[model samples]
Target: MPLPEKEAWPALIALCIGFFMILLDQTIVAVSTPALQTDMGASYNEVIWVTSVYLLTFAVPLLVTGRLGDKYGPKKVYAVGMIVFTLSSLACGLAPDMLTLIIARGVQGLGAALLTPQTMATINRIFSFERRGAALGVWGSTAGLASLAGPILGGIITENWGWQWVFYINVPIGVICVLAVLKYVPNFPPHTRPLDPLSIILSVCAVFFLVFAFQEGEDAGWAPWIWIMMAGSVVLFAWFVYQQRRAERAGNDPLVPLAIFRIKNFSLGNICIVAMGFTVAGTPLPIMMYFQQVHDMNPMHAGLMMVPQALMAFVLSPYVGKLVDRSKPGKLAAAGFATTSVSIVLLAITMMFDLGLVSALVAMTLLGIGNSFVWAPNSTSTMRDLPHQYMGAGSGVFNTTRQLGSVIGAAAIGAVMQVRLSAGDPGHAFGQALLLAAAVLLVGVVASMMADDGTRDPS
Candidate 1:
C-alpha cells in the first residue's frame, strides 16, 4: 500500500535531519582542528587522526549497515544509531583527553555508518517513483548545505565559544531527530537471510588494514609494517571475494553479492562515484587548512569563504536533478566532471598567483555548481535500475564505496600536501594536489560515459 503523503514526509524529514548531523560533523571537525590541537595538546598527526578515525569507521561499516537495515528495519536501526550518535557526541564534548576524544569520535563514526544508508533506503521505500528524483534532489541539497555550513559553524563556535561546542551542538538536533523518528517512522520486520560472519570479518579486516596503512603510511615513512598491512589487505580482499562466491554458489546469503558487478553500468558508475569521492571529499580539508593556517584567515572568515560554493550548489541542484530524470545522467555527469576540472584548474591558477577573495569565490562557485551536477546524477544513475528488494544492500555498497574513496582521497591529498610543504613550496604543492584531483574527476567523466542508462536490470 502507498504511504499517506503526510505520514511519509515526517519520516523523510527526520531521516534528513539525522543525515545533516552526520554530514555536518565531517567538515565541522575539520575547521576546528587547530582549536582542538591547542585545547588537547595534540600533535599534528594526532589531530589529523581525529578526523581520519571517524571516517575510517564510518566508511567500513556502510556495506553491512545497509544490509542490516534491510534485514532488520530501517526505522529500528536508524533510531538506535541516532541515540548512539547523540550520546557519543556528548561523550566527545566531555572528553578530558585526546585518547578519550578519539575513541568517542570513533563511536560517533560507527553510529553514522549505521544511520546513513537507511536514509536512502527509507526514502526509496516511501516515495513513489515519480517523486523519487525530487526527493533525492532535496536529499542531495541537504548534504551540500551541510558541507557548506559545517566549516562556518565550526569556525563560529570555536572562535566565539570554544571547540567543545562543535560536538555539543549536535545534542539538540540529535534529540529532535530521535523523537521525530519515534513518533512517525514505521518499523518493518527483517528479511530472512543467513548472516555471513566470515565475509563480514574478512571485509572489515581488509578495509581497516588498507585504510590504516594509507592514512598513516606517509607520516609513518611508509615503514615495512605499512607495506605488510597493504599486502594483507590484498590477500584478505581476495579471500572475501572467494568466500562470497562460495556462499552464492551454495545457495546461501553472501554479505555482498559479487554478481552486482556484472552489470556494466552499475560497475562503471561506481567507479565514477569513487573518483568523484576522491576529488571532492579529500580536497576540502587541506584547502580549508591552507586558507586558515597559511593565509592566516580566522575560522569565521575561512568558513564564509565557502559560502559561495554552498549557495551555488543549493540553487542549482533541483534543476540538475530534474535534468537527470529526463535526460542522460551520464552526459550530465560528464559535463559536471568537465566543469569541475576547469574549476580546479582555475583554483590552481588562483593559488599560483595568490588570488583575492573575489577570485576564490568565483572559483568555488564554479566548483559547487559542478559538484551539484555530479553528485545528484551520479547517485541517481547508480541506483536507478536496481530491484526494489536489493535497494538496501545496494545503498550500503554504494555509500561504502563513496566513503572508502573519501578516506583514500584524504590520505592521498594529505600526503601530497605533506610532501610539497616539506619541500618548501606549499602553494605549488597545493596546485599539484588540485591538479591530481582534477585528473581524478576527468577519469570520472570517462567512467560516467560508460555507466548504464538504467535500461537493463542492475543485478
Candidate 2:
C-alpha cells in the first residue's frame, strides 16, 4: 500500500535522523583525536586508525548493503542498522582501550553501511520524481549540517564532559529514531531475483584490497607488499567484471547489473560524483587541524567557522534541486565544479597568506555554495535516467564510487600532509594539498561537461 501523506513525513524524518547520525560520526571523532591519543596513550598511527578503521569498513560494505536493502526491504535493513549502530555507539563510549575503540568504530561503520544508501533508495522509492529533488536537497543539507557541526560539538564535549560523551550522546537520539522507524516506516520487499553471494564476496574483496593498499601504502612506503596488493586489487576487480558478465550471459541476477552503465548520463555522472567526493573529503581534515592545532582556534570557533558553508549549502540545495528538474544538469554541474575549483584556489591562497577568520569564512562560504550546487543536482541527474528496476544497484554503484573517492581523498591528502610535515613545512604542505584538490575539482568539471545532457528527464 502507498503510504498516506502524513505517514510519509515521519518515515522521512526517521531516515534523515539515521542519515545525520552516520554523517556526524565521520568528522566528530576528528576534533577528539588529540584527546583520544592523550587518554588512550596511543601512537600517532593508532590515533589515526580510530578514524580510518571506521571509514575503511564504511566504504567497503556500501555496495553489499545497498543490494541487501533492495533484495529485502529498506525499512528492515535500516532498522537493523540503527539498532546495531546505537549499540555500537554505547560500546564505543565504554571502550577501555584504543583497540576496543577501534573495533567498536568498525562495527559502527558496518551499521552505517547498512543505513546510508537506504536513505537515498527510500527517498527515491517514496517521493515522486517532481519532488525527489527537494527531498534529496533536504537529505544533502542534513549531511552538510552534520559535517559542519561535528567538530564544534566534539570539541565542546571533549573539553567539558569528556570525549566519551561524543559516543554516549548517540544513545538517546538513536533510541528515538528506532522507535519512530518501527512505528512509521513501511516495509517494501524485493520484487527482484535472488542475491548472488559469490559476486558479493568478489566485489568486497576487490574493494578491500584496493582501499587497503591506498590506506597503508604511504605509511608502509611503496613496498613490494603494497604493490602486490594493488596488483591483486586490479586482478580481483577484473575477475568481478568477468563474473558479472558470466551471470548476465547465464540469465542470473548479478549483484550489480552491468547494463546500468549503458545509461550514458549515469556512467559519466558517477565519475563526477567520485571527483566531488574526493574534493570535499580530502579538504576538511587538514583544514580542521590547521584551524585548531596551528592557528589555536577553539573547537567551537572552528566549528562555527564552518557554519557559513553548511548554512549556504542548506539554503541553496533546495533551489538547485528545483533547477535540476527544469534545467540541463550538465551546465549546472559544470558551473558548480568551476565555482568549487575557484573556491579551492581562493582557499589555498588564503591559507598560504595565513588569512584571518573573516577571510577564511568567506572562502568557506564560496566552497559551500559551490558544493551545494553540484551535490544534489549531480545525484538527481545520475539517477534520473535510470529505470526504477535498477534504482537499487545504481544507487549502490553511485554511493560506492563516492565512498571510494572519500577513501582515496583521505589517504592521499593525509599522506601528503604526513610527508610535508616531516619535511618541516606543514602550512605550505597543506596549501599544496589544496592545489591538488583544485586540480581534481577541475577534472570533475570536465567530467560534468561530458555528462549526457540529452538523457535528462524533463518533468
Candidate 3:
C-alpha cells in the first residue's frame, strides 16, 4: 500500500531525529575530551582512548548489523539499537572513573553501529530516485549540521553542567527518539538470510586490526609492530574478501554480497564518501585547537568559529536538494567537493598567520556551500540503482567504508598534529593538519566526478 504523503514525511522526520542523536554523539565527545581529562585525572592517551574506542566499536560491526536490519526489519533493529544506545549513554554519564567511561563508550559504539546503516536503507526502501535526492539532502545536511553543532553543544553543556551532562543530555534525547521511531516509522517485511559465522569472524578481525593500527600507530611511535599490524590488516581484509566470494559460490549468504560492487556509481560513491568522511570529521580538530590552544579562546568561542559553515549548509541545503533531483548528480557532487577542498586550502593558508579567527570564517562559509552540494547528491546517487532487496547490505558497506575513513581520519590528523606541534609552532601545526583533510577531500572530488547517476542500470 502507498503511504500518504503526510505520513511519509513524518516518518522521515522521526528517522532524522534518531539519526541526528547518533551523529551528535560522535562529534560531541571530541570537544569534551579536555574536560574528561581534568575531571578524571587521566593521561592524554587515556582520554583519547575514550573517543577511539567508541569509533572502533561503532565501526567494527557495521557490516553485520546492516545485514541484521535486512534479516529482521529496520524498525526492530533500530529500536533495539536505540535501547542499547540509551542505556549505554546513562552508563557513560554516571561513570566515576576513566576506565568505566571507556567501557560504557564501547557499548554505546555497538548500539551506534547497529543503528547507522538502517537510516540510509530506510530512505532507500521508501523513496523513489527522483524524490530520494530531496530526502537524502535533508538527511545529509543533518549529518553535517549535527557534527558542526557537536562542539558548540558540548562546550555549552560541559561549561554549564559538567562533562557528565554531555552524556546525560543524550539520555532524554535517546528516549524521545525511541518513542518517535515506534510511533512514526513503519515496519516492512523482513528478508531471511542465513548468517555465516566464519565470515563474521573474519570481517571483525580485519576491521579490528585496521582500525586499531591506524588509531594507535602514532601513540605507539609507529613501532615495528605497528607496521606489521598494518600489513596483517591488509592480508586479513583480502582473506575476508576471498571468504565472502567462496561463500557466495557455495550458495551461502556472504557477509557482503559481491554483486553490489558491479554497480558503478555505488562503487564510486562508497570511495568518495570515505574521502569526505576524512575531511568532515578531520578538519574541525585543527580549527578548534588553533582557537583554544594558540589563540586562548574559551571552548565556547572556539566552537562558535564553525557557525558560519554550518549556517551556510543550512541555508543552501533546500536549493541543493532541488538541484540533485533536477540535474546531473556527478557534476553537482564533483563541484561541491571541489569547492570544499579550496576552502580547506584557504584554511591552511590562514593558519600561517595570527589571523586564523578572522580568515577562517570566510573559508568555513565557502566550505558550507560545498557541503550543501556534495553531501546529499553523493548519498542519493550512490544508492540510486541499488536493488531494494540488497538495501541493507549495500547501505551497510557504504557506511562501513565511511566510518572506517572517519576513524582513520581522526587518527591520521591526530598524528599529524602531534608531529607538527613537536616540530614547530602550535598554530602552524594546527593549520598543517587541515591540509591533510583537504588533500583527502580533493580525492573525493575526483571520485565524485566519476559517479554518474545513470551509468548503471537498476539491478
* CA lDDT of each prediction against the hidden true structure: 0.82, 0.82, 0.84
Model 2: per-residue lDDT, tens digit, 1-459? 335557776788888998898888777877787888898899998887888788888888888888888888888888899999999999999999989999999999899888887888777777666666766777778877887778778888889988898999889988998888888888786757776677899999989998888888888887999989889989988988888888777766788888888888889888998888888788886777778776897767777778888889878887887787677777888999999989888877777777776777888999889988897778877887776667777788888999888778877887887777788755677767787788888877888888876663322
For model 1 the TM-score comes to 0.94
lDDT of 1 by residue, 105-176 (tens): 999999999989898887777766545556677787887889778877887898898999999999999999
Candidate with the larger TM-score of 2 and 3: 3
Lowest-scoring 10 consecutive residues by lDDT in candidate 1?
Answer: 450-459
Model 2 CA deviation exceeding 4 Å by range: 1-7, 419-425, 454-459
User: TM-score for all predictions?
Assistant: 0.94, 0.94, 0.95
Indicate the worst ten consecutive residues by lDDT in candidate 3: 450-459
Task: Estimate candidate 1's RMSD in Å.
Answer: 2.1
Using lDDT as the measure, which candidate wins? 3
Cα deviation of 371, candidate 1, in Å: 0.6
Model 3, position 350, has a per-residue lDDT of 86
User: What's the lDDT for residue 402 in model 3?
Assistant: 91
